[model samples]
Target chain A: MPHRITSARKLMQGNEACVHGALYAGCRFFGGYPITPSTEIAEGMARLLPKCGGHFIQMEDEIASMASIIGASLTGTKSMTATSGPGFSLMQENIGYAYITEVPVVVVNVQRGGPSTGLPTKIAQADTMQARYGTHGDYQAITVAPASVRECFEQTVKAFNFAERFRTPVTMLTDEVLGHMREMITIPESGELEVVDREKPDVPHEWYHHFEITPTLVSPMASMGDGYRYHVTGLVHDQDGFPTANPNEIKAKMDKLRNKIVRFADEVTQLDVEMVDDAGIVVFAYGTTARAARQAVHMAREKRIRAGLIRPITIWPFPDDQLRELLAHVRRVLVVELNQGQLIHEIERVAPKTCKVAGLTRYDGEVLNPVEIFKRILEVK
Target chain B: MMADPIQSSNVTYDYLRVKKRFPNVWCAGCGIGTVMGSIIRAIDKMGYSKDEVALVSGIGCSSRLPVYCDFNTLHTTHGRAIAFATGVKLAKPSLKVIVVTGDGDGLAIGGNHFIHACRRNIDITTVLINNQIYGMTGGQCSPTTPHDSFAATAPYGNMEKGFDPTTLAKAAGASYVARGTVYHVQQLDKLIYGGLNKKGFAMVEAFSNCHTYYGRLNKEGDAVAMLKLMKEHAMPVKAAKVLPPEKLEGKFLTGVLWDVEMPEYCELYQNLIDSFQEKDKE
Candidate 1:
């Protein structure tokens, strides 16, 4: 396919691409701390954000970084922060605050090996589960995984759009390999990509409820100085955004926090499926591991074996419906990930009952190769 | 419009979120309410429109003060109010930002943020309500909890020395730092008002009474007695300067402890942006 490029094409690191993507998406404020594998994103943001008339602050820590972005977003600026695993762990508390208060912000986690500072500069997808359940709460998460440098740019833009549209924190999961690896990519020019801003309340300031529940479930947000003086709290709040403990109001608030994202799951789910229509065996993978999975699928097809690849761009609302429909006829599915086993559990949940789901795991801080995954595919028979 | 808080009760009512329930979450005679009134009176006296101000707070009894006030209020996670207010101020710079935090919330769990916020010298007014205990979570030892004072966590009595918040702020590069007691309500208002008018990071440490927790746990009597203790122990900074070391040993200093000029973070950031973008245009 001949692609139209309105801007200059250049060789860029994945992290550099992410910074450009964030700028293209109208992100005006960045608050982050320095961490390995992901530091480039913060570095690039610091170097470039000022030229764009935006602000970049290196916070005291990841917790403050998360808190700062939420605060910036309240003032109607598109804000984001970048960090790795240990820092992501520190950000969980404030991420939960963003979830409960329904503030729109983006968190970019360039995955490094971790249980606790496991491998600072190595590749690992162990945070896939952490991205969903890291915060102590019962709210659904919106996370996107990008496998390539080009996808890194595109996925980050999509991440911001989802955050603004859903009025929730969005996580972009890119690993060490993708974050540091340089690749040739065509940067999208201004006005080329669709940028979505948060919906502001149209009602009079007196009638404005910060968390007003409408048919869409998402509320129109007002910036701090916009004159709609409303209260936002992490406490279970009513539609007017005041803390409330009334049982009915509590349930309704929880339901709104959930269904706001859950009901729009299909719209949030992004998937790339190749040759899965008639394949008897398929590999499920995401992030950098999906590159090997794709290559392995091609190798199996060349050998006259029916094989396919399914990579989810959106990892958290985890493409359940798409996988169910795609895997109905598949007899066996192999999950390839850089972790011990993460997405396999979700695949096992959604795969057809007749299909055997298995995980080809690697956690020694090494990327999976096409041969190793192909060998696993042959063993699936 | 700058009416005295004691003389005018009707003026401060304009700042309350009157639609919300009355009889706030604080215990009776708790000094947090008095500190809240002081803040409200300070903002009222300054004549800032409620729409142009943002009140950010972390988790605690004092943090709940923002929810009751008519302004853009954000009650964030524990120990993160200053960090959030930093973003709010840096994002807008036009909005008057204030952070209401407690001893445990501001100086302990959030100590790093508190010090860093002071170091940045951003344009933010922080009202640190130091009751010397975690009042909301019951009587637990805080960063400002007195040495050998009883608390739920420090039942055998706290061994660590308490932090002098005004001194800490001064050392951390704050442009303005002041100490006041809830017992000195008018002075507290003046101190907070001084913080509001300052251009850079401002810290107003208001020594409040956690009578429900710190008072009862230490057998320091009820809220009234705690207020009396504050009144008795407080000394003006000017008076303490002339007094002997022994005469000021157990007494705390009231009024502005430090004041200086410093470049505000937001303005510095904007200048950097303008310089860079102007060069880019060239």
Candidate 2:
């Protein structure tokens, strides 16, 4: 039997907390394949979803998992799927389909190692760039990385909200260390956190255009069987959601997709800052590495070395504007991650040239420790 | 027997989204349009409201059926129509979900989803339009391309044997399996109507003609010649049973090949949910 959390406070694994978060955020459908380091989320949903009048289907493969969730979401149900590296790689094609079609779905990638079945049980943040640019086409991604079990619950709810509000897929980037590790987390009761649902079309069925370019650029969506008999295609389509080859309509369609997320970048990016006001050096990190960087910053402050941390909860839309302003005065910015200089290049692109941006990297399927981050901070400073 | 909607003089165009696009992308005299007409007539004969049906298709010439139809339509990725329709059906079992896919889209790249969907016995209706070639991508060889047939990828001749879709679906656990052809319009309508009315996973393989690609490459004249080929070589399942094996050598059998009752995936899942809720009440 699946353990149902009745109390507000409980000690839970990060993956378990994600299931709670999804349920709390009104995710009623889950379609996923069993992948290592992320199977717990699927198992939990399989046990619990049906009792709540939801549906859980174990699809044939990761691609089908992604496709199924998109189909479920189209029927006005909030849906999600979870997978690790190999599964996540298989999902790229359908992920691109979701983006182009503007379907609201949540994908949880519990980070594992490598290019080809690298380290299924170990942790690596190598997929950080893949989360941003894994899909072939040009589109913005709303991705969130959680550092703790508590944040796993919180960030998952946030991921769904972002997905619904933006009408796109949001990637929940968690790694094996946080996915399997246990921590005390206070689960929010009902109505404690804000839950946003997608906007619905209010027009008559005949006037309803599935991809209307509104002032907000986020068109209202209509579910299947709602009498708004609209056509949805993965092809480049006009506002009516039918395939079109006209160059002008095609440009407008692409612009509508791009502008909806880019125009609202501020609302999509979330950061956690610590002691950056009067510090000469700042640590830029995310996911589990940010947890180590947090402890490392405190250790540096105890030694009076003037160190701080900027941990991004929302890792995409790249947090460009915020990082540029934060790194303006700091002389040294150290990018910490479990991969060989993936996110560091992103940091270098935004950080002023005078601000010497460097990377403290590791890629041998091991976690980065606070002491190692601290030593790197000392060397970079 | 359902009243023949095809023979009725006042054929309702209510199920067609005629305003969406004028003159669809299919070639003139393509058998896909005839197959689409049969689907419309079948749904109309069933008296289903346009709002209650969802037409989903993947990328292909035959997959374009949904865009011109006045239903809750979804034209999805290259070969993921069955996977997508599974979600739609599982999430809202009240809505009738139908998937339309071609030979390449349904049997080649989407073969795993196809067989597994049957294995699960989900309540979905799949209309597999088999033209034996990838018509949209310029006559490439497909999984259903007959052995020794010529294609763009098989310039000399195709070396692989074609799949028998009805046999495949029956083996994969579909509760209903049938085969029809565009040449037999009324029979195709009845086959699709029967597949749609079945409760579990149902597959109706409709033989269509891709005169532009498959016909031109093989010197099969035009759409008329290709369809005439189907009329000449196709026999009903009953006729093949009594005929000698040597006598029916090159002939393909049509009509219902398999039909049985099985528990559906969604209803079984709903029962699971009900059991848990009942225990909680206790």
Candidate 3:
């Protein structure tokens, strides 16, 4: 049997690849405030974007940067902002605005230690839950975690595509290690990529309903001056982007936005499974910590633990159903993350109580090493 | 009898929907209304179609200016107006993007955006309504609050120095930088007009008076007295040459401080699209 070859060429860091991914995916505007670990993404965008004819703005603060990107996106340009923990916290209100308005934009959170600028340059994944619920509202968000620098490029492009396709903000949750780690990315020429743009209404501009969900529940966005007279607001809005106080209208809009992605879960959720078919123990992880877990699973196999690894590329929609199916036959499930037991709770909710579940948690501004995770896996077994 | 001054046919205040409603949000004797008037007059002078202008603002009393304007207006979150306006302008480069922000909204909270917007040199005109104190927040100290100025937050007087908005704008690479005061209404109108005519990021800082907060706190007298003092105090840059620093003491120089043409962010983007299309054709 012959193995298939991919033409994905390589030569970039995770941050640099993110810049390329954004440009390839048609992102024309970047508004960001410079913070450690994530600053490279902004710096890279500033240097490379001019050649491609995109605009890069380092805003006054993270709040403005986040707001500007949403504004830029409303104008029909793919826009994004990158920040660390404190900055990400400031972006919550505007993020909620994007969520409510159904504005398509990408926000890259390169996780650093936080609760308030905890460690400006150190790595942590504490924001995993924040990524899901940082903004004040009942809303669904698409968040992607890349385990490697190469995945940083690939996942960033996917994040932008997801944002456009779903007509919502997508977060690329990167951690400090991956953001700063230089890696070889085989750069594909512009023509070899699959870039998705938002679906525009087939009806004429006047006939267009800004938030009117069709069969797919995703509406086409019209730019401001395109003669499309429509309103956009932060409040719970009806199909025309006007504020609606009726509970039914509010529930309908919120439910549609939340359910669209979850109903189409198979299309949005992605994961990498290793040795799960015959293994008795399953180890779950995501983002950079997944790298350590992968190595730990291999170590567990060497010790005859028969451990498998599950890495969720897409963190939200939680991969609950898929994990439940995977966990039914396993004797034990062990979750590993840099945060102190954040994602493990989600895993426990999906996995049956009959199956023992445990977490290997760490939050000292350091990556959870494979050795520590291996020890924990053995201890759990 | 002297013929009525030729009101340039271009100058027509026909479409500003909110101009007729007086008693604006600005404090009594506040310079913001005068600065706003100057901007409206300048737009009228330039013959800019109101339909083509999009006014964006962040959270502040000054940010509320957009809500009053008839054209496409966006009243956005605090300190994020420029960011939102950037989006509006990039999305429609043909639309005139005007951001009306105050010292606190534009500088203190929105300061990062102010510098970066200038750095990008996006084709937009920004009127930074600098009233020194954060008047909307009940006279709290702001980034542009002059050193030793009194505010609720600065009970012992502000020890930190204030930013010279024009100098900062120029240093941050704004293509055009100008200074004016509400007292100098005609000069402000001219500066705004010049800023609107410029092709890249242009900023006109209007040294507005906040008679309610900054005034009462600083013992700057009542609104009428302050207006009289402004008239008596301010000296033009040209006049300052013959006059000593003491003669022109405490008076701000008003005029266009910097103006130059540079490749704007949007046009460069358009050129890229054009070139890409050309390459495809080849």
Q: Candidate 3, residues A334-375: lDDT per residue as tens digits?
A: 888887789888987899877799888888988888999999
Instruction: For model 1, name the residue pairs that clash.
Output: none
TM-score for each predicted model, relative to the true structure: 0.97, 0.98, 0.79
Q: Tens-digit lDDT track for model 3 on B21-102?
A: 3345666666766776788888888887666777777777777665445556666777878888887777568888899998
* Alpha-carbon shift of residue B20 in model 3 (angstroms): 15
Worst 10 residues of 2 chain A by lDDT: A1-10
lDDT of 2 by residue, B1-282 (tens): 886574455354666766557678899989888888888888898889999999999999989989888889999998999999999999999999999999999999999999999999999999999999999889999999889989999999998999988899999999999999999999999999999889999999999898888898889879999989999999999999999899898899999999999999999998998898888889
The per-model DockQ list reads 0.86, 0.86, 0.29
TM-score quality measure for candidate 1: 0.97
Tens-place lDDT per residue, model 2, A1-381, is 333567878989999999999998999999999999999999999988987889999999999999999999999999999999999999999999999999999999999989799999999999999999999889788899999999999999999999999899999999999999999888886788999999999999878899999999999999999988888898999998988899999999999889999999999789999999898999999989999999999999999999999999999888889998998899999999998889899898999987998889998989999999999998989
- Model 3 reaches an interface RMSD of 3.2
Q: What CAPRI class is candidate 1?
A: high
**Interface RMSD to the true structure, each candidate:** 0.7, 0.7, 3.2
Interface RMSD of 2: 0.7
Query: Native-contact fraction for each model?
Result: 0.91, 0.93, 0.42
